[model samples]
Target: MFDKVLVANRGEIAVRVIRACKDLGIGTVAVYSEADKHGGHVRFADEAYNVGPARAADSYLDHEAIIETAKQAGADAIHPGYGFLAENAEFAGKVESTDGVVWVGPSSDAMEQLGEKTKARAVMSDADVPIVPGTDPIEEPDAVRTFAEEHGYPIAIKAEGGGGGRGMKIVREESEIEEQLESAKREGEAYFDNDSVYLERYIENPRHIEVQVIADEHGNVRHLGERDCSLQRRHQKVIEEGPSSALSEGLREEILEAARRGVDAAGYYNAGTVEFLVEEDPDRAPGERLDDDTDFYFLEVNTRIQVEHTVTEEITGIDIVKWQLRVAAGDEIGFAQSDVAFDGHAMEFRINAENAAEDFAPATGGTLETYDPPGGIGVRMDDALRQGDDLVTDYDSMVAKLIVHGSDREECLARSRRALAEYDIEGIPTIIPFHRLMLTDGPFVDGTHHTKYLDEDLDTERIEEAQAKWGTDGEAAASGGDGTTTQELTIEVDGKRFDVKLENPGLPTNGAGQQAAGGGGAGGGTTSASGGSGGDQAATLEGQQVTAEMQGTILEVNVEEGDEVASGDVICVLEAMKMENDVVAPSGGTVTHVAVSSGDSVDMGDTLLALE
Candidate 1:
């Protein structure tokens, strides 16, 4: 076993890895950014170090800083939790090469071979695994058109190193080919540092199924089971359930075996997931199951622990994270394939800090005035949030995950309803209401909803109603303040965060403090990463300004000064919360001024361009 393990990530996953290390009697080290100086993971770990600023590029994604922190902490191993450098082959190789530190995941060679989508598809094809017809790394738009000629319309332009919909775009018509292709490549480069992209024949209706597999250094591999993540919005999974109710016994076995074969063929080890797209039969009855003949194609591989690994844990009595550590330490499998058995059905709902009624807009700023999670038999909550903690809007929107287990799917749904109802949150907009609404949704309850169901089929009015009924008014709590005469200062010593308190015995409290208590304070306003308010830019900009709708980095400015644009024309692309949003022109006009460029950090309402 390792003496000390450094977690090179933040949020719940970092806390999760720390807990696993503690359970195995290993020391844990946590790395945090300035924005996360007060993060829950930092408090939970035995020791913590500051990496960089709030912007992920300078902090969480800085491979060198994290590696140096691990060295300073005397951590013998580095565990890159999902996201950031988790799947980066270069970072993994660096950790592997470090004198006394080991990387607690698959070998860098295996990650490089499978992390790239085009290469993974080639490997899967050689292993006789079914894959969707697609083209290799394509540069020109003509390649997309040519592929579309044979594959037909609705082509999926995917980044070579992208997953979780970060660098993916769907083109449904000829006119959208160039725009979607550029956006896909731009996202690919911005997110993965790779502009390489490929094409796939988009499946109109499919169930997103993935088999979780883990292997040890002793060459023993095991498939935990399958998870259905069809409940998605814009290709990002919102909910996931294990032992899919839509797959028959034979079909399930086939998919699971295929996943194992793909992993074994790639010479992979440690934790990984083999994703597949199972075609859904629209004409089939509501309760009908997919048989052996149903078409299923390999999607891609997630080379690290998944967010919904909790679902598999609830159904199977296996501690996947523990196995990850054991395998990395050169341990052999303790059980055979047949010995692995699933106990019951389980589902995981992502508790994201977004408003589903407003197109799932990520919250800009708010404090967790009240935070309460449900608990009981068959219910588990994985989170790192605390009451009064201000919501960190710098990274992803996911606040936590809710996992529910039951003897059967019916009972699981019933229990989920109770758990969601019992879950309470305040001062931050979340998708709790949407999850509650899904319990009564017919298609979802029948387990027939495909990956595109939420994006294309669900009614918007019902979501609005759900939000109106159950949603919290974040503005009130975000603007509210508590009276205090003492002011605290945050200081850093050798890249370690520390808090200092300064007290004034006779200081007047009736000025700023009293006004803050009456709803006027720094908490009432949101500042961009560049330390500027969006409203300030809007006030000075002239003409018809196209302002950002959320806080993110400007990935691309489509129109420059003097460029003519029409209504609904994309003026720029904004990357936010791991998703890309197009900022379009409100009306036909000529571009007068461009306020932002690629790689500029922006907040909600910051002007991107002005039209005359």
Candidate 2:
């Protein structure tokens, strides 16, 4: 019941919080960076403030600036959307200390307890929640080795502060332990600022299932079913479905009850998720399955609203954000555990502006020229991006989430297919085609996929087959030529080659459409008497390096001195986009030296190490 709340994040989740606040008649304040001045979230806020420069370090993540914004806006509380400061215990503590500014998340003590994986596991185990067998925080490298020996090789060294699969390494044998340990420590320190890591018995072929728990100041906690986030790539969840198809009624009850107990034990409040790694083994003989009984082990506890909360809302009809505000206002748990019901089935696919063929690398581009999200009964698209908005490289690549609700898993799959097919976006590469393939896959259709599904169950052959269906050169080139003339050039939309022919051989009289093909002359060699037929426009093309489309730093360069590269051998990694897009050999021939380095800024199409 806050009169106003400050949303301390950006992108879709920030917009989501703002909408929820509006519905409750609560005023909302948005903080934005210079880059996000025209962002969807900024426009949606009741009032907005310019926090800092476009860089996240100077804007969204600046704690003092955020606090000051909240104070200036007279916000009664702050909602830290997932990511950035959402799980920052110090930020939560700061908000709590500031009079009249309540922190609408788990208490700092609970975050600290759950932030450390070892502590969380211990706490869950004490509450009778099943957990993977692993040593609680080893103090030395030798201790890590000792745990590895007992747990049978192939253990995972995980950072106590790790969340997004970062700060983790899998050691398959004794020899690789030391190297993996150091790597894990380094990543932990870099990402979480905590070099401390612990070992866990790596569960091969496990399901990522998590139960959402909401508690109130009255000490009442309730379990809101669970979400099966098994479909993933590179340890990041790509698809999530509610009420895991793998769990039986008896097992589901046990896991839900266990999660409730853990929340209660941790003295938790507001919304949180207790994630577990469920062992997916169907080959074991009856009564010989240790995994069947204690399969779901505590992985970590998310101390705030999850990105996939929409999936839960789609099926349950619960407003988790409303609950957060209400809880902050001293409201008791609105509904008892029994009041919660699993209506149908819900699934969420994260639609990131990333190229799936290139390992789900992030992509950057300007506002979509065409932004059409699929919407119908049982389908919902949550996004804060729009056409013409600059898709900067300074933030997370996920632009939206495609969610579907159906009466059953099959219906959900069907809906997912329809939703993905209906979704259309232009300007940047997306994982839509990849998700479309996932929905049609057999293992996924049969509900047999696990956390390792993307790695183990993915049909690379089928993806290649699908890619072939669209014709090679990946999805980017698949769109091909639409047979439209933007300037004086005619782009080949359907052709396999990037043959841009000039239909009208003349200088571009207007600033509209794609780049003009051929030289800016009325006829080849017939330079118009007007100096250069196209005036200064042609002069601007000289000595331009094609920058990356997104915001990741560069990682590699495939082209070298006079080396011939086909149209698609990766030229260099445009790290800005958090993806490695090949500055493909735009044309076949020898490389004339790469213009960019291993680390350089690449915009949409600045000549990246050009082709001769």
Candidate 3:
């Protein structure tokens, strides 16, 4: 194994790689942008170096800066952890040619072959792997229409270089095809720098299943089974698990074989994922299915460690990062297909700092407090953040991954529930509530979920109902429980805006919306904080006076003496934990007093602007 390795990424994944390297007695070097100088991963590394600014383009994606850092630290190799430059073929080549510094990933030539979706599909086709039916490059809208007719309606127009659902549009009607196709092309060019596009028959109600493949220099290729990444929103995976619940034993074998073949054909080595869209239509004939009743078809290949690789690692005792390092050092295959044995089931929930009720909109805030991850036999929490850390909008929204393992799928689900309940966070919005709901959900529990699980199986009505109840009133806030309020309220003080939220209430409430009917009490009312009719109380704050919801510096005071304001009116703005929240008026009433001003810092329960 290499003596030293540099992790060319940030966030939880960087921390994950560092831990793996340390376990193998390898000194680890960490490269961080200015934003991550004080991050957890930086402090965890044996040595750390500053790369550039927070913006990914100026730092993580800056290949030259990363290479120089590795060279300066005298790193023997660099591990591009998943995102930034993980899949950049040129970056891999640059590292490989630089004397002793190796790239701990697949060969550059392999990446080049699989990087281009159109080319990879052709390669998979030639290898006898079943691929989705679509044209190589459909430049015109008429071609899309023609393909749609042949493949039937609801086909997808995808950019040649698109992955992660970017630069792709689903067209369910002929009239919507032309505009969406052009839009996809534009997004493709803007994001991936490739305007080229293709077409595929959309497999409705398909599960996002992927097989993990590892190949060594000796041409020994093996698979680490499949991960069911069906839970997603906007094409991004939210939850993932190893040993898919949908695949039969025979189908699993077939998909695993296909992934091995694809990797072999591309000369792939190191860590990579072969993604497929598994159709859920049980009524389809075997002839209609892609591979003799196997409904799964090739989607694309991810030529790097996946965000959900922890689940795979949990199920299989083998450490993927260690294997990547060994392979880069010219080692032979560490384990054969038969040598690898999977035990138990594992699941991972991606805890993003985003609100699930509002289309999963990403939110930003600084950590007011932090808690150590819960420890148990089968629970693992991976995070690269710490107390006083800033959650910026400059990168991906995911803050941590909560992974749970157990003897079987049912046990894993139960453990996931216990883990989510124990995991605690504050000062920002998270999807923990959604995950809690999913753990007990019928489709999820029954293993009938699909890629559109978030869209199809989710109880949006209930989620909305809960958001409406808690979003406005202090008593109904999402994090308000145990007589401790942990909800952030946006208020306008003077003319500026402020953002704030609750933190570490001990016994935190996972965002499960509101409690079931007859849950709260006879005295409690689920009234909208914003002006609305229906709840028993005109406003939930009738007995409880409205106050500053979180710790923040007051930006402005919008109310004056005897100034009557309606509910939801911009009352004041507090800049709390680095976010601007607008404090709205709880009811139509005259402003009794204004207690704070711009630049004045205050804690939760401090009266900034009060309505009488």
* Candidate 1, RMSD to the unseen true structure: 9.0
Best by TM-score: 1
Q: Rate the local accuracy (lDDT) of all candidates.
A: 0.87, 0.75, 0.77
On residues 511-563, what C-alpha lDDT tens digit does candidate 1 reach at each position? 32333334434343433322334476656766766777778888988887999
Off by over 4 Å in 2: 282-294, 464-475, 478-612
| lDDT by residue for model 2 (325-428), tens | 89988988767777887889999999887667655656544457668899999998789988766676577778899999999877888888888878878666
Poorest 10 consecutive residues by lDDT, candidate 2 = 526-535
Candidate with maximal lDDT:
1
Misplaced by over 4 Å in model 3 are 282-292, 465-612
Error of 2 at 424 (Å): 1.7
Sort every candidate by TM-score, greatest first: 1, 2, 3
Q: Indicate the worst ten consecutive residues by lDDT in candidate 3.
A: 530-539
Sorted on lDDT, highest at the top, how do the candidates line up?
1, 3, 2
Model 2: lDDT equals 0.75
lDDT of 3 by residue, 1-612 (tens): 899999998889999999989988999999888877887888899999998986567788898899888889999999999977898888999988898898999888888789888999999999999998988887888998889778898988888877888778889999998878876876566556688999988888887889998889889998999999988776888889988877677788889999999889888888899999887864533323224376779989999999888898999987888888888888898677998798999999998776667666566444524454566989988898876677754566788899899999889988888887776665566777677667767777777766786876677976655444334321234444454435556888999998765453433343342333434432344333332331222234333245655545565567786787887888876654333468887778877656677656555455555456
